[model samples]
Target: MARRERTRHLIELGGLVQKAGLVELADDDRATLYGAMLDCAARVQADDAGTVLALWKRRGKRAFDAEETAEEEQR
Candidate 1:
């Protein structure tokens, strides 16, 4: 996974997210999607520990938020 490939993957994910309709997503949902995209990008950009760490941090927050929301809804 080279840098160029990683960038391309990110761009594609972004396109998918847009196509899915950003307006339909709650802020937390959008954040979750963003985190997923970043994680994918990091995987494609292998060996870049800094990038991986950053994405993980961001994604983790979003994922946690989403989970919390889901739990609240169930309660």
Candidate 2:
């Protein structure tokens, strides 16, 4: 993906995270998310559809982890 597109995706994901009340993500978690986003974006830019999809899958896992952590904290 283009730089602009990558930035847009990151912003979109950030919004989703905020709405999910997962804004308390640790610095390491945030970095991981950002890094994954960047990796996927780069893959897309390189026209590697498979790699992009894989990166997105990884990103989803990270998001799930964040959500689970937040829920656990409420208990």
Candidate 3:
């Protein structure tokens, strides 16, 4: 059960990557996608990581909220 849950979690993360257009932007190249993700990780490891992470968190929340609003309007 735990393994299944972990699989689902990873799949959802992959879905976010696809949703963000990285898959298409990278021409479906796994290496490019992984490299981009590693770049993001490196940025978050910087001295001002907290500020960078907060900005990203806010942007993600706004995107999620916007998506939800659009879906609700469609319904």
Put down candidate 2 lDDT per residue, 1-75, tens digits, no spaces: 599999999899778766655455544387766676687578788887887778868987898899899999999
Candidate 1 lowest-lDDT run of ten = 19-28
TM-score of each: 0.35, 0.39, 0.95
Residue-level lDDT of model 3, residues 2-70, one tens digit each, is 999999999999999998889999999999999999999998897499899999899999999999999
Question: How high is the lDDT of residue 58 in model 3?
Answer: 97
- 2 versus 3: better TM-score goes to: 3
TM-score of 2: 0.39
Candidate 1 lDDT, 1-75, residue by residue in tens: 699999999898776566446535735486777676687777867877787778868976887688789999999
Task: Report, for every candidate in turn, its global Cα lDDT versus the true structure.
Answer: 0.73, 0.76, 0.94
TM-score of 1: 0.35
lDDT score of model 2? 0.76
Which candidate has the top score in lDDT?
3
* RMSD (Å) per prediction: 10.9, 8.7, 0.8
**Comparison by lDDT, 2 against 3, better one:** 3
